[model samples]
Target: MSVATAHVDIVAPAVPGAAPGTVVGAAEVLDRSNRRLGRVPLRAEISTPVEIPHEEQCLVHGWSPYLSVQPIVVTGGRTQQALLSARPANGKGSGGEESRRAANGWIRLWGREPDGQWTVRDPSDMATGGATAVSTPMGSPAILQIGGGRRRPVCTLVPEGSLFTLQPTEHRPQGPVEVRPVADSGFTLLESLRLGEWGWATVVERVWWDEPGVRGTPLFDLAVAYLACRRGNLERAGQWRQVAGNRHEDGPAWIDVLAVDAWLARRRGEWRDLASALARLADAGGTPLVAEGLDLLTAELARPPLEPRAPHPGEALRSVLTPYLRASLPSSLTSFTAAHPGVPQPRPPKRARPSESLPFRVERDTSATRIQWRVLSGPPVDSGAYAPVADRTLLPREPGLIISELGELSEWLIVEDEDPMVLWRLSRTLLDEGVATGVSIVPGRNAVAVALPGLQVRPAAALLADLLGQGRVRRLGLSVGGLRQELSVPDAAEAERILAVLLREGHRSSP
Candidate 1:
């Protein structure tokens, strides 16, 4: 029997120099007999509709220009082939050379079996009638349908906050239907789609009760937490789990939940928990995506250590996990690390011996007000040694607090502030004390990343008479679990003087 297929038109706008029409290019889906089923339209502002070509079959794409494997819907014990025909937007409707180059695109195809084998083929080009076909048996794992450029990864299938309606299905007339994809302004469509692709079983359950304007269902919460975990926001992920309650009525099974919890434990350097989690997931049945994640993680754990390249553990995990799943794991890893502004650096491993390396590395909390730190890497084992590995401790600092790294070698004090007066006051504070060697104002973060190169020295309170006035010195305090030292500006008059200095000295300071 021929496999059933659906027509999904993945359309995009003429980004720069393509046709000047409502749609750009599209993917026309067909069954083994070349019969049409249905189509999923793509665009910048709208969503690729959640159209199940057949029961148990789903058409999914990452939060990107590239569509992922289309889970073939099989019934009545039959297997067949599915075909994807790429149709690029025709003619230079109205654009220039630069515009045309901006609009140029390419396409590719991939196939997956129930046993988890995937095969990929690079089509020569994407022209009308240039179709990429795959054989899908009734029980095959997946058949991918993708469309995008070789270089481009991000493509908008749905804008954040868009609305969706489930309508009615034959089996359940009183379906738990409502407007969908949910208004998650905090995350992008690719992000959510990645969650869908990676959390397949979880996503299936999510649609069961997902409705417009609804928030924090167990399934949806787990997906969001998984996204946060992928982004290295372990603390945030934990909080989301709390919001959704650790357990829910129809949430993931205990084993699947253990999979996520164990992954978090691994990030915190808990190897035993990771092994235990993987063991449980292996014994459990029915959660393929979680199993896939576990398999990817297990391989990485078992593989021999590579040469030191200063790659974070998170980065290593991302590299291992991205091939099997379709969401933008690379970008999430990038955005979750210090490579991207505001991405919190994981707390440094605890140190057994003091080193001359930087005393602290800083990252922001969810509110973006306070700074957080883990211990900086321990002293180098040798000049030619691999990356510094901090002491693997069982306990880690809570990332939400204002942790401070004060000690005898606390020569540097980093002050991140936007006010020019604050910067000027801070520079004077560091310079007059002769404690800091350099003061740099980070442009993007609008905060100062100070370098205190001198020996242990604390600025005297009297030095700030001009700024502190008669308010007298309050007790100096360290917060964020001692990651930051707080200096309060007490008097209104003193605060005014600092604010007044901003217009004149703001640009004078290095920014």
Candidate 2:
């Protein structure tokens, strides 16, 4: 009961789910002990001042079934919002626009000001007086934007149930330290919540990225711009096209980017800018996007839409765009394409018994009526066992793959991995209302991949991404069914480094 809430008050829900333009009544908050916490008034903005401990919980309603709070450090850009809401047993929540107001809470954020001191601030406050915020028109519950216009989004929310995603139109913080999260004076938003009158929070380091201008992979933005312009949202289309233009001036993607511009010029009937962006774009001739942009100059939603993972509109366009990327989480929001080429679409684990996919087994202390996960057969993990990874010579594994030494890999890796492809999609349905466990999320090519030891997969949550936000973790949990299976993240910095590796592939902490 030693939570930071101070029991001052309480309230709750997951990513807001109420219909748009429609307001809801008061949402009540209660803890596992059936103790009444507080209430959250509807449509409240961030800055609840609710300090979350390592673990916390609350029950949700409507399409909004539960409230789970975890603070994450993400550099999704200068500004963005994390959506929270209960889905079916599956991570995919109900229909889109169902619960944009699922849960309401101001993410706890820490940033260094010009004065060089790390202090807490609301996510919305991170932006300057004139910064722009962008988001899908019909996305999840998010904090209010500081400055919203045609360019800035008034609602700061993303879709519910996604494999932790990034978009092209969204800001990219790869190489430059100034644009990176927490590296600069700009505050990186951490996850925290306030739904209605109830404020719920958990210890989590959510990762995010952002950008104010239009910049994503060239080809993707061209396609987006073509569709946006045709749909009468020239302002938005121009935004995507601008990103495409910034990406490259002479290439297939660039050619396509310009065709849209030329097409737009014909429509609005103007051109001639500070730089001849049009000249460089049309340099490369007959590109997929260019042809399409010209063809659809006078059409309307002729094709539904295109996403990195979605099925392509035509085989010809597929050549330049490769395969259409399906959104990591399908929802009502418009897709904001980015330039993460090798990243695959997320495929969350299918429903199944834990023993089939897990190296560890579950047991019930019937006497205590408590459930827990334990390693199949192993003494306590040696905390000091993490030494340098024994170097191994590189071997050609396939035409495009090679095996290399585990340079910085920890030596105490999972040795009991019984199955290499086991992925368990934990059920979101909790039988016990008050049970809350601290957990970590990893961004993966496939569905919500939970990181565990010895799993073969690319990193999901970047270990480096966590370094600036909140480092690796501050201890968390996962509730399987209604049973609270507590996983401990040792306080040692080395242990955290190892856990980051394990969670990067998306799994609960190991023994």
Candidate 3:
């Protein structure tokens, strides 16, 4: 049989129930088996109104009740004195006024030496009695010991307001403790679910599932699987989901899990499985999540796979030229083409008949600085010449027949035979003079329309008024398909009135 030995040591209480300013002594006694034996009595001396002074060491006393049973003598060094002072006692109120008041006086002692301050010589150092040996400092007041206890009380003087108070008590060990309101399995599941939503599913599994001595909760594992799927971790999600399904048949309904599975299948390009999964979701009353999955799957299935086509030159040319024409033409033509959708076939130039001869009409404005040319023939024959025209110039004709010309010239010479000489001479004159004067000889209405679609009468009238003054256009004539309208105004005022009439009726100028 082994005899147990008990050992003691000091300790601080773990509980926070002590009153303010209360100081106590604590101890722990252990048996040979290392088990707790019992608490021991410890005496402590607490200074009243415990003061924490700057740059000064304070003295406190601690004792154990077991010390009495197993007597132990503790010894230390010399006594040092610190100066203390007390003020006169105030007589605020007293029924027994005859009682003599203690002297309103003070006490003072020298503070400990700068190097080695006050020290305790013996336990009786704090006894409430006269010192055996002493020589009072000349200017210092006498020191006093007000009380006695198992622990000695040293004599130290203090100011009236600086009296330190002491209250001592014994401490006991607390009983076995436990936390309240243990969490349920569902609560754990919810916590895991929340963490998984925050992209911490793997962390949850490592910390809560695979940890040593950890207990796994079914709902929590399933929740982790669901979050993994949502994060696009399909393989991990499927593994966990399989575990959950195998472990518990009455788990979260398949409908809740099928939507994510379908999405995963689609991502992995498992079209057959994706279709099956989506069908399952739809049969599950097609919840919003399920419906979204089905919609995505449907779109994916409906899309036709890419069938590469060999490149063709004509297609490439059309793609390039189409944008160029649209940009170069006027906004009116561009807008019209956009509004009317088709293959965007170009408008064919008017065709000339083999038997007909179309002549050109040339006229000069009153200033004689501008020239205008028009083709005079019904449609078919009215098709204008495609050859280049010339402007005014000097030419040595046929050795002696010399001709010099100035001012604007019409390059619209109608020839019975296809004569390159006439066309060449005309083109040279037009290029020199017409270009210099910024004049353009337009052949047909189609060319003019293409160049300046905004030249329709209403806009043209506005432009004329802006260029000249208001009502400057006195006469206007336009013909299309042999249907013509001619309007003449006596003055600017009458011209504005007629222009207003035409504008309101949507009868734009026809070329």
Candidate 4:
């Protein structure tokens, strides 16, 4: 039988930026004999309604190769309308005698089959001449009316290399649904199970551990501990496993728990326990599992070296002074005695032999009552004549007196009622016996002599004595013309005399 042909409009809603009169394309189908079947041309311009009432428009630019359709309900306020237009290849018309067309084809719309095939039908039968009808098939190339009052079957048209697309009439009821492009069932199931397992592990670790009723669940605790071990939190993992042991038949599997225990023991330096646990794991077929423990064990085989203790306070001081004393000594004594006149002579306490140099001398002062003086000098003296003499004196009637080594003296005669006797006694004592232990006496213009037992003479004794009395020693003595000296003693008596001479002579020479 020869098939009859009729033109049908396939309408669809307009997409944004599409030109007017655009259509969706359809798939090309072949018969069982491998012969070319009919081509269903897209005939209508599909459009969506604009916000303004009653105006319909579509996008149709570059849509010539595709077919589009829209299903309609007869009872709606206005049936959704589609305008038909076609542009053939090379800008030819699709509708007149001179129009180029597909070979001897009839139009068919189909409801999608369960086996991914199509069941063809006609559009004319779907729209009756007057009233909408159901199940009316018109001739060999016919339109089947499936719904008006009855539910309509959804029909979809798809083009090659695209997904099948469907549009439903408003009057049609919901039916059986299926998803296309089915995914691999095994892969999907595995991924879902893995995600669920990790979620459960997280809940047990973070939430269940603190929950009142859930805290006693051993399986949950074990799972959490296992995850903790995997994450390298040995301390927390061990605690969780220990708690789980009380509630579960098996706690975190023996091998994993033992490995964590071994790691902890290794950190605490319990090498014996670590070795025992590692051996046990190896015997139980867990040698590879305890690899980290074995590595830690190997590292512990070499012991670290010890550090020396810090020096004591006395030791530290001696250490610091040793080099300083060796470099300084006798030369420094000249500056030292000049700086501190109150210091006593640097003397050996035993009586000196006639050939020996006297460190200091004691001389009686006849001019003053009960006044005995000590004197210091730059070089030790064997004869009493070389000792410093009390050249100047002041009586109680005098206000105060200053005796310089070079015979320069000052008296505060304006204050005579003051106890000048004390001043006189002090001056005589220092001049007779005081010995220079730190500084030297040198001759100079405007320079007074000062006694320095151990150092070279750099300044006159008078200026050195003034500097000593003023206590401007170390800092003031650095200048080139200044007599710089340091002091040292082989014994304590010499040191004591040096101190005494400094105090006595300092008071004697005070202005």
Candidate 5:
């Protein structure tokens, strides 16, 4: 019989009902068959919090629950101590007020530089937390800052549950070579369908945008600045803000970017810098909503602070700044918007032209409990022969809604485009609607990969062919049972020539 320690990542619960910050010794005991036994209490000699690397288990004995059952003790690497104690299913835990006040699932990352500073990224405060209201380090877990922009010249840490990793692997030859996932080098994308939309964005951007020569989009820089400032890295934040300012002169989105920079400066108490950023921001175009948001910030800035009577004095200032920092233009400042009112508005920008719908097939082996999706470049199969295993009605029909009934393993919704902007738009649309689970947008290439579970294959392929076929999606690939096909892309005519030859030779080509 074999026994193994019950393991968990940084966020797993230790004691089923143990209170947060309350010290408890726990060890799992097993019988000869290695089943049907409960935990046995141990001596509370080690006082470390019940977190990763400290907690203990007794599945085989002499193993820390935090470190799984690994025998070797690894130390002296950059150690980050995060508070990941388990909260009760009802959101309550031990230590009463202490447990309630303790930051659960929040991680404190440490870099090799060994600074004593701790930066916080709280979601409730937009002014400090940036767009996502969560603080992320300037580097590490290298996937966050995608698009081959300039590397952040500082150490950073990846989140515990992050789907992407910086660990190095075999390289690929492409537009921009994949960099090592070192603290100094940038991050690369590993194929993942499990990460949420945010994870996809980070990985896609890293692979597509964070290139050595590629300058990031203005919005991307603004986001970086927000994260940098929140982590008390004013130098890094200022650098990113400068990059953004250099990329834009005037526009509503630009105004919001400048406003965020000004807000960060204000938070850092750099009054002179704040004034300069606001001056630049005021020069940018503003709508009625923008004016109102700015007015709120100015009003709050002019108001006096509560005389320590308020439970949280910072809350008042945060309330005003949050809206201003979050405000952004719906669309980018365009030539049409900048054109004179008397003059005719310039023609709308052209979009991608629709291409041939990539042919695909879906098959399921119920006995094996597996499914397969194949993108075909051959003759199309008759629809009458195919039937969906899952009911189509169970899936969401709304433009932005996602359908997921299958378990946690993510299903994919793959798109092939040569334009990053198109991929970004589609990704943002799906993400905003909570449909996109994972995304892979390679920069300088017109290809995208995303994961969305709960979609029936037949309808999903049809739906994509309809919506994306209208000049949005060029090719599509949806995977099931780990089956996938790769396209050897060339010029259109060249690709057709190759395809014709392959078809003549009886090759089952990929999309």
Candidate 6:
């Protein structure tokens, strides 16, 4: 199904040039939309509804222009009809360019089957010839029914309950995102259709992302943690997991826990970290079963490793062991252990011998904070036991507080910071003092003097006062992600003053 025909028009077309993927309401059109519009590098505001063909809409790059995705947020934008979807670059809209129809395809709903396959849900209670047959009027922002079409006066299809809803994973660049919502303003767009306005749209009572907001759910954190694990940044994954540990109700979504368990096992003797993780899993949702398996397989860090032994009936194994069916557990640990290898024998931390060429080197990249390992020296002789071979670039899911590795490095490297203060504060906190510290300040967009000043650095916030007070640096602001696999901000002239104050306050002395 073409996106236009499939996804409901999600926005009421009043505000223009608003942020992509944001849901705004009519009441907030002036406040939120206006503030976002001000941030826009361009001035593309056109509040009056303008007609543009679907094919002319620009394709949004990031989680944008979800024009066809429904349960719309009332946002304002030049292409107010579309959200993440944008105007096709080739179009001047009113010019003499030939117009082509946007392609359409089979509309599918978001659902999964029991056997790990995806399937579609029938839009029951929906008239067979409802939305697909009619063109979507971008001007509206409600779930319009054929009978509920044309919000001239809202048809009564809503109070009856929706036939189906889109259930997407949250907080993903490719998935769903929602901004904060306001109190339910008694205001609503009450236009309803009599016969043919089903797709025209009316004001929904509790619109998409407006009532009790998305922040209340753990789905966003789960999705973020999942993505961090996928990227092989265990530090970030662990941090997010900690943030979400209290959300036991959403434990089923930790889809990568097994892989996490495997990697955690490889850490020299991270039995504590591994145990904490498993405990959370048990208490949160998949306890008893998952905990038992992990303890037996990944928990041991003994030398020479304990020989594989058969279980001697479970009833008295431990006080925590509850009676569970054998079928619930894995039949074989041999393959699993061979694939991931149980706990590695303990060794001194990597920083102990900085001069030695190591088997693996973990570092982060500027874009999208990814923690990856590039093989340095070949893998040690027992490399076969480790699931991740030394030759391959490995994105480890959990490296267990690997910051000390960076602290011990004695090399000259440039870690560029879009926000210099974050680079300053974090590196100072995480790295060993005087790890060849130097500060780079770009006080103004047009400022010529880029300085590598020799001063005791401090918390990023203080830099703003020093540099900006001297009328040298631009304004400053701040934010965080884990260092190993995350991202942060600051600027220069004002940056200097901020540094002085921070240093005097003893927050940090070097970066």
TM-score of model number 1: 0.24
User: For candidate 1, what's the RMSD?
Assistant: 27.2
What lDDT does candidate 6 reach at residue 99?
24
lDDT, candidate 3, 161-232, per-residue tens: 111211112110111011100112222233334333232233334433343233333333444554555566
Clashing pairs counted in every model: 25, 77, 20, 66, 19, 53
Model 3, stretches more than 4 Å misplaced? 1-202, 207-218, 248-252, 286-511
Per-residue error at 79 for model 2, in Å? 24
TM-score of every prediction relative to native: 0.24, 0.22, 0.20, 0.18, 0.23, 0.23
lDDT of residue 459 for candidate 5: 36
Quote the lDDT for 118 in model 4.
Answer: 31
Residue 371, candidate 4: Cα error in Å is 99
Worst 10 residues of 6 by lDDT: 332-341
Off by over 4 Å in 5: 1-210, 227-233, 242-244, 250-253, 279-511
The candidate scoring highest on lDDT is: 1
Model 6 misplaced regions, further than 4 Å: 1-89, 92-99, 108-120, 125-219, 226-235, 245-252, 256-511
What C-alpha RMSD separates each model from the true structure? 27.2, 24.8, 54.0, 56.4, 25.3, 25.5
Model 4: residues >4 Å from true position, as ranges? 1-204, 212-219, 230-235, 246-252, 286-511
- Across 1-511, the per-residue lDDT of candidate 4 in tens digits comes to 6433222223432222122332223212122122323232221243333111121111111122121221111111232332322211122123322222111111123332333233454343332111111122322111111111122211111111111111121122221111111111111112222334343233224444554344542223333544555456767766765765444323213443554555556556565666666565545431111122223323332223111242211233233223322222121001111111122122212222222111112222222211111224354343332322222222111011122222322211110111222222222333434432321111111112233334222222343344335443321111111222232223334433443444335445544
Question: Candidate 1 vs candidate 5: which has greater TM-score?
Answer: 1
Who is ahead in TM-score, 3 or 6? 6
